[model samples]
Target: MIRNEIKIKSEEGELFDKKQIALAIRNSTFEDDLKCSLLEDGILDKCQGCSLKYICNGIDQVVDSYMEKTTEIVNNFNFD
Candidate 1:
């Protein structure tokens, strides 16, 4: 499954910071319990006030449970 998407509070073409979002993800115990589908669900739970808007921009993709392991976001990209 590919979580190759981004989320944001607005669509004003904001260039958010990835390090901050990464840090939040790392610090979030609940985030650790989240599935690998980072960009698929409502990240507001994880990225509440985050700055990594670009990472989830133009994101309308999804990866259901049937998602494969050799997919894009899970296999190719490493948000960690």
Candidate 2:
């Protein structure tokens, strides 16, 4: 995944290395599992009409705009 030196502090005030966190995240299937559960429960269907459907964590207008602009630019490109 992404590499960084960010340290995480636990509730017990103990600091841990970012490598441990990265390893845990890299080995986790939490996002796929959550998406599957939400789809089974019909939660994902509800998000179909939402404007922020592309965003998983939260609403980011900048990313949405960038995606739209990128798509438009790509569509206008002459690949032939």
Candidate 3:
């Protein structure tokens, strides 16, 4: 049988509906907060010589661009 409702377990052991988790993540400040924390902890020094250092350096911008495009695509999707 196919299941219509899907659930995910959090690190805290709480069960949440997949849609609920998706919505929560979509509206969260996790990326910005993580960037702030990394900057505060001097992530640049830690990421020295890493191949993805350049991408990680501007992750906020990259995520913003990706989200913008994703939102546009979702908004333009044909749900009919």
Candidate 4:
């Protein structure tokens, strides 16, 4: 799917940062463990004040879960 489609499919449904999520996914390995650790361990703390934080938080209902949801979005991403 294209970036717009991905954004629409996301839980935030247009309220989040599709580009940031895409970038995070591209930067990550998408491994379950790593994703979990990133969220659980403050690895994404840099995103704390990001404008997309609400969308990211909406993805998992936890602001820190940005990496986890990003991985999920990337893993399930489809190209058309």
Candidate with the greatest TM-score versus the true structure = 3
Write one digit per residue (lDDT tens) for candidate 1, span 1-80. Answer: 53323443357775556655554444343234334254456545664455665444312121221123223563565588
Candidate 3 has what TM-score? 0.27
Off by over 4 Å in 4: 1-14, 30-33, 37-80
Q: Arrange candidates by TM-score, highest first: which order?
A: 3, 4, 2, 1
lDDT of 4 at 77: 56
Which model, 2 or 3, shows the larger lDDT? 3
Distance from true location, Cα of 11 in model 3, Å: 24
- What is residue 35's positional error in candidate 1, in angstroms? 11
What lDDT would candidate 1 get against the real structure? Answer: 0.42
Q: Quote each prediction's TM-score.
A: 0.22, 0.23, 0.27, 0.23
Q: Give the alpha carbon lDDT tens digit for every residue of 1-80 in model 2.
A: 54354566679775778565444443343332223356567767666665656764432444344446555443555677
Kindly list the per-residue Cα lDDT of model 4 for residues 1-80, writing each as its tens digit. 43633344445555666676655555444433223445568766676666666765565444346545554433565699
TM-score of 4: 0.23
Q: What is the lDDT of residue 30 in candidate 3?
A: 48
Which candidate number would show the highest lDDT if scored against the true structure?
3
